[model samples]
Target: MSDTTRDGLADRFEENRPRLRALAYRTLGSAAEADDAVQETWLRLDRAGAGEVDNLPAWLTTVCGRICLDMLRSRTTRREQPLSEINDPPSAVESVLADEVEAALLIVLGTLAPAERLAFVLHDLFAVSFDEIAVVVGRTPQASRQLASRARRRVRAAAPAATEPRGRAVVDAFLSASRGGDLGALLELLDPDVVLRATGEAARLDAQGERRGAEVVARYFAGKAQAAVPALVDGAWGFAVFIGGELRVAVAMEIKNGQILGLTAASSPAALAGLTVTPL
Candidate 1:
């Protein structure tokens, strides 16, 4: 294509960039990943000229969806790192809503399988037709509807519930305090009657016992859980400790009203397999 034609195509793509980024953000929870997906979409459009497509907006949306679907699928095959582990700051391209509804929606969406997430986000949130969604998920229209239906049920069942902002914030703070050996910070995050229980490998390692009282629990976790990462354990916010890329221990906590009330550490293979632990 000539310079004028190429420049015109670029202008059209730029016009749809904001919406494209939004589609990607809802499909994949991370702002950084969404920006990457949008950039990939632009690259594809640049290489495959827009002459063959009539509806540029719809075409760009589809391309971005497919890219996000691929990324979601790849998460299962990799030892994924949370967005917090990245060295760079969060992307500015994402929309930030400082409401409980937006935060809860993203948390609930994180629990869904990749296909189910893509199906539901595209059809329900963006009003994309099932036919168009099917093209992205590689399923028939009927199957895509089923995926969305299943996702919808899960979302509804979970709508009235969510991992609260305080839950994640406390876990992050506790982890930071523990890693830094800051006993004072740890005590501040724990309740006066805080308790810690252990099982499996942790038990065999003598890290087991019911320790009560904030000072006791705080001292135990001080400078501990060094290899832990923020994760969702058994539907709540927690941490998974890894040693050389292998999950060695998983800690599930019960936080009530901004305090860390209780924690259970498990390390057996069977126990770990049963827990649905994902990045927070």
Candidate 2:
């Protein structure tokens, strides 16, 4: 690289450094490891150059995520302790998400499978679309959503809900509102940007491949959830639908801050077999 080109590349990397560092820190849950991951990303970018990386920020995030995943796997193999806050100054992302992302939550994240960790942190926290997240985690978008949804359930299970309703309570409320066809109540339970995903039988019943927005989602659920009852889907506080007392589908949810952020309906028989569902 020429001097001018090299300088320009360096400047670009510098500008994106904060985001990269924050991504690494959250993914790794250790300041030292995060720094190492960020450095490695910059080194790779230096070798690849501007032409090879079409979007610098996205490229940096993907590379850093892979590096963090590798590190996490290695740590797991070594039987290391769970991640702890390393007392470093808070990055901009951390400062902004401080209330949303707690220290105890980091410990919980550290316990999740590395792929689940990456999926949850990347998609749920950063709002990286499942398509982009799938590229980083080497999974299809649907599978990536499942991984994040699973990880999210664990996070919710570990959380205390003294201040607001969460977990099964929220799902039950949604179901009751849906069964009653109460559009107003359904809208209140869902986030404005709530997303609904369905597969197999549920998709056919709802014709909702993937829908978003509170209004659309609320309308879809109005007079729906008739047979879906509160249940433990995959050991999480979720819901399941049965036809004539046979398990037909499972509803995996992503509830946060007392609102339904995402709802994924698993209706494929094979997929249901893989999941451990039980009525509540």
Candidate 3:
């Protein structure tokens, strides 16, 4: 690639990185894998002589989607392990999306063929046209639409029953239980296999590599819940704890199956600054 082309690609990456990341995350269901897919997309673009391309953004997105599809295909071979084993444990962002796109949704997406997943994400999630999806999936426009339709039908059939209202109630209950320090109430709402992840400074302090199971989380909370008061983080149900009015920890919960399956607590003051906390 020429210097001019390289400069142009760099500019395009700066402009489109967030959108590309969003697409990959929605398609892959793992933030770490999404980052990998985006990186791979840039590598492919560099190899393809992207400086010569007129539509750098579109080209990058197509390359990113294709890379994500390839990664998803390889992921199918190892489906038995929990998602956290294959990728990083769920983060605050995943917890935010869990209410609308839970584990069931990810499983359903995994069931789809690569082309089908690409078609569906591009068309339904990104609002791309069939023509554009056809280019990305390497199918005719009609075939792309058919692929998306098939994927949509499968998702609908396998999806957990619409749980928007129920999910909201669950979050409310979790907050209530946490504030009251009711371990029994919290465990009652949590799955037996619940997974808890504490990132940034919290992970360093605990040195427990992100707790899992109802019992493990209960014990961890027994210690920290006293120190951390409840508050909302990032417009979702969350808790913010302060030490002498200085942010000390931020907790975010992901509830599924009437239980808490994922909880992420950030303790690094640097990381905490980027997060917005609201009164619970």
Candidate 4:
């Protein structure tokens, strides 16, 4: 391509960067990863040479979509630990969008299988045709549509209520026991097979990736939540820990039969923002 041609293509690519990054973020749920995906798309476009492309926007969109789909697949195969912060600083657009992409929504996305996430993100968020998505996911067009449909249903079902005081009471009780160093009380609040999973900063603090059994779990939190307070985690009972009035940690619980079945701590900015806490 001539200098003019290359310059024109570059301009077009730059014009589409924000949209591409947004699409990738929605699919991968990591701003840094989305930036990487968009960069890779640029590389591919350069190597292919833009002369043959009839619709630059559509072509770029498809390429970015396929790249994200592969990344999602690799993430599944490796069971990669979820990170709280993006590698890159948020641009103005990203910061604005991040606020809109509630922590609850990301939590729900975590539950989806990779293909379902890609299908849902591409078709529903970006308006990519199912036929194009089929190529990325190795599914037929009809199958791709079905995949998105299932994801949509799951997202809808996962929406949080404004309040569930029962959950709040449980979280408060757990926090009180933790602050009081009441191991027996902690054990009483947990199920026999309770599980504790920590991600982002919380995972590093806990040392191990997960802890099991009521005794082990109780010992870990026996006196840890001195600064923790009740909060709504995606509309469920949870707690938040703050330092100097800045939110630092969010704890989300899974309670069943009035006992703690599972709990998660997220120290990432995204997770912290999703938490709804009362004044200290």
Candidate 5:
């Protein structure tokens, strides 16, 4: 393609960036990841010449959707360090997305299966039509419609876990299971989408930063927390690790609907100093 053609294609891609990014953000539930997917879509378009594309917007949508789907599938249950672990000023894109996406919605969406998420975001949110969604998810149009229906129900039902915290009885059981080193019991108390984030000395126990999924999180805590006892960290239901009567880590569980959704552990001396702990 000539420079003029390439330049015009670039301008059209830029025009479609916002829509592509919105679709990605809703599907992946991460603004940073959404930005990356849009950039990748642009790269693919750049390589495939404008002449090869007839409908620019629809072509961009399909490409971006596929990229997001691949990202969701390739992601592992355990993540070394989540973006939250990094301390950096939010970029303009992230800042804008912060207001556009609701925290509870993102949490709920993050838990859905990849095909379901893609289908729902494309058809329900963006009005992309089931036919187009089917192409992206590699399912028939009917199957894609079913995927969106399932995702819609989950989004509505799972909102509470994102809004308010519950599951103290579950936490008690989790701690009991952990103390005994019973992996089965520990796994039973965790949510499929459970995530664990630890900092300071706590990172030594499991790989630092974050770990996800019930099985992964369960294994991390199994046969562990032997020195930990139930307590309140900053007025929330959690635990504190004491080795030889010294508070080593302040731990908290974000429980929802009778299961644990998130676990946060702070073991640094300075971080430990700020918590209000009450033994129970």
Candidate 6:
């Protein structure tokens, strides 16, 4: 392509990138995969004659939708035997909304057909018209609306009660107990069969890969708190982590009923390289 053609495509991408990312994120529920989908969409546009397209935004959306659909279709097969299976870590949005929903919601969304998920996100979340969603999802406008309606019903039926302020207080207490190295208090807050998992680069940095059960996690953090200084993470009341003074590891938590149900610690030096820390 000529320089002018490349420049035009770049401009088009810059204009529509945010919308494309939003669509991908709502459909996939994974920030990293959404980023990859957007990158792949741009690569495809570059290879094709996108500069000649009159509706660049629509063209990009169509291409991105197709790419995401393909990924959703293949996701099951990939999960069955992934070369490197990484769980989707909570993005900032997911973290805020985590307490409002159950793990079952994530599982249900993951099971949705791509077209259904796309239609729902566009119409419900993004407020796109069925006509526009129809184009992206490759369905009739009525069909798109119906798909979105079905998805909405499922979400509503399964939605958990909103997380109350008191629930947040419990989470805060758990963080304080963990930071103070109070093993007894920590155990009191946790359920007996609590399961803990981490993802992204954080998983590798974890000494035990992934720890499960309340007792197991309690022991793990007890050892860490005994050895290191605690630091506040992400400015959230419930977020806390341990730093070796030389390296900063970020720790995020999900608490329920005053128990630490889930914890994610990013201890990889590489993951820590770009982070800024706050004193506890």
Cα lDDT, all candidates: 0.78, 0.77, 0.68, 0.75, 0.75, 0.62
Model 2 gets an lDDT of: 0.77
Q: 119-192 in candidate 5: lDDT tens per residue?
A: 98888677898988889999999999999998777555443333443444566788889878888898778888
After superposition, which runs of candidate 3 have C-alpha atoms over 4 Å from their true positions?
A: 1-5, 76-104, 158-280
lDDT preference between candidates 1 and 3, better one: 1
| lDDT of candidate 1 at residue 15, scale 0 to 100 | 85
List, residue by residue over 104-213, the lDDT tens digit for candidate 6: 23434554567887787677666778888887777899999999987766555434312322334455556566667778877887777766665456544357568777
| Candidates arranged by lDDT, highest first | 1, 2, 5, 4, 3, 6
Provide TM-scores for the models: 0.60, 0.54, 0.49, 0.56, 0.54, 0.50
> What is the lDDT, from 0 to 100, of the residue 279 in candidate 5?
47
Best by TM-score: 1
TM-score for candidate 4, please give it: 0.56
At residue 197, candidate 2 shows an lDDT of: 86
Cα lDDT for residue 215, candidate 4: 95
Candidate 6 segments whose C-alpha is farther than 4 A from its true place: 77-108, 161-280
List model 2 lDDT by residue over 31-106, tens digit each.
7777899899999999998889888888888888889888988884422222334454566455635553464354
Off by over 4 Å in 4: 76-101, 161-280
- 3 versus 5: better lDDT goes to: 5
| Candidate 3's TM-score | 0.49
Best by lDDT: 1
- Worst lDDT 10-window in candidate 6: 78-87
**What order do you get sorting by TM-score, best first?**
1, 4, 2, 5, 6, 3
Prediction RMSDs, each to the true structure: 6.8, 13.9, 17.4, 13.6, 15.1, 15.9
